[model samples]
Target: MNTIAHSTPVAIASARTPSFSPWRCYWLEAKHELLRLLRTPSFVLPTLLFPPLFYVLFGVVLAGGRSGGDMGRYLLATYGVFGIMGAALFGFGVSVAVERERGFLTLKRALPMPPGAYLLAKMAMAMVFAAIISLILAVIAVSLAKVSLQPAQWALLFAINVLGVLPFCALGLCIGAWVSGSAAPAVVNILYLPMAFLSGLWLPLQILPAIFAKIAPVWPAYHLGQVALKVVDRDGGGSLALHLAVLGVVTVAFFVLARARLSRSQ
Candidate 1:
């Protein structure tokens, strides 16, 4: 009986030892999230289709035999940034809200999952989608739009564009945590359209009103667009360092807010 009692304690101690590694949990969650995203057409289709369609409509059709010097190249770069932004916002924001509403996030939290693992997995998934969208847009731009970019230029723009979405993904997380599922899509659209338009994703900043032009630098989309333009050699008198700094600040701020909100909810 003493031996049995002692063995029970040992077994309990062993069981209490952490059953889940944070990284493993994150990876498993990320994989599942990716699969979930793939299976959901409402999520996957928009991320894949919207950017390319936007590019085709604006970059190719609207530009319409009016080669505005480097304008075509500029449009290509902007649309790529636009696509990345869409991926980050829709993928992380709407989905996170849906998960929270559906009780999926709650279920995961009840498990041995690390607090940050779910968010990390989500951010990784956003980056993956951004990269794939960037590639698809790049291919379409080169082949159909007659956009010509050297390999190095393509690589540089792709890398920076993907990195640029990090802030948006973080911002989306905060939005997801704060907003309700029913309101998320509308909230996202309200944020998305303004950011895209104000930041010159739909059109160049020079064409925008002076007020919007002044505030553009304050937005991550503006910085991301600047980064893309720089890579594509289309940024006219834009400061790379300034844009990068603003994006960095915004990312930090959003992350803090998201962490706080998420912690409080728990």
Candidate 2:
């Protein structure tokens, strides 16, 4: 009886343990998240195609024809920011809301994996999408638009896009935590489009009204856009330290809010 009891406890503990190592669990989660978004046409098509299409239309065809390579280089930075914004917002926002509604989060919570693996997976997935978008914009800028830059500039701009996705990811997490799945897309779009425009992702802020230029700094996208513009020496004379500080604060604030809400729900 004693032997049976001891073996029974051991078997139960083994059964409860996760088979995968910690890093492996995180990797698998991220892999599946990327695959899931890739398979979703609504997500994949727009995230991958829209920025390039917009760049081709505005940056390449029109702007390149008018202002020559300068416009292309400018738009390259802006549109790269735009592409990453879309990827991070939709990827984190919609997926989290839907998964939460579907009880997937609860299921994962019951599993034996690390508590942060799910969120970390989503973050990694967003960065991957951001990287792809950045590369595509680089190709379009170099080949079609013929915009030239120093090697370090190109590398810096790409790094900005990849890391810049984090703020939007945090904002998306905040929206997803607070809103229902059905409303998540609408909520994101409401903020995304307006912010992009006001931040001069489509056109330069100098062309916009005075008020918009004044208020542009309030949006995290504007700060990111400025940092990106700095890479090409086209920024609006804002301090790099100021932009980075604003972005850092925005990221931390949204992430804290989202984490609090998620913990409450749990």
Candidate 3:
């Protein structure tokens, strides 16, 4: 009786002892994902450099006196969208396929960490890359391109670019779910490059044929481009509400498709 009484509180305390918080695990998992991406030169270099580099070439040097600030501001917004798309698509699309094949994804799923942690980490990494690209582009636009905007415009553009990552991540997830490890790169390029051009990231749609302009709205990048352009008040013509709705639909659809695909593969 004495021993039982003495041990009761200890037993109760042990029973009530908490396990490691899943949120901490989630944070660590997210940090690891970000670090892993940072360590990969192939991933880091192109994503970080391409936007600012292209902006310097096209948005500044070649664009001097083209339309005064119009071209620079346009390129600023478009290239900002382009950069985020690249980061999210490559970060999730290529990484997911490769990881899925290598069994790392499977292993992670089997671990005690929350299943959502893997996805959260990937999305966080994408956002981090987006933020980096935005900062770099803003610096170059102000210092080198002489592109000026109200602070509010800059803030709005940054917000658009950061949130713009979500739809592409979903699209990338779908692509990752569909492709093999080796084919992921080819598939992503097929989707990324042509869409960018078709959606007028490379040139104004009005400058292209009417046909190209007609097709532009079909691409998710087009909607994001419109939103980005609208921030600069250079959007050609489209209800902001419509562009946002299309993007919302695209995001939800791709995510659903990706979820189904991943669920089946497992």
Candidate 2, residue 213: the lDDT equals 95
Assess each prediction's global lDDT (C-alpha) against the native: 0.82, 0.92, 0.91
Model 2 over residues 36-57: C-alpha lDDT tens digits?
A: 8889999999999999999999
Q: Model 1, range 151-263, lDDT digits (tens) per residue?
A: 99988888887787899998898889888888989999899988888988888888778898888876788888988898777775777788888888899998899778877
lDDT of 1 at 140: 73
Off by over 4 Å in 3: 1-18
Candidate 3 per-residue lDDT over residues 30-63, each given as its tens digit = 9999999999999999999988888888888888
Q: Find the candidate with the highest lDDT and give its number.
A: 2
Measure candidate 3: CA RMSD: 2.8
**lDDT score, candidate 1, position 250:** 90
Report the error of model 3 at residue 158, Å: 0.5
lDDT rank order: 2, 3, 1
After superposition on all C-alphas, the RMSD of every candidate to the true structure, in Å, is: 4.3, 4.1, 2.8
Q: What's the residue-level lDDT of 8 in candidate 2?
A: 81
Per-model TM-score on C-alpha atoms: 0.87, 0.92, 0.93
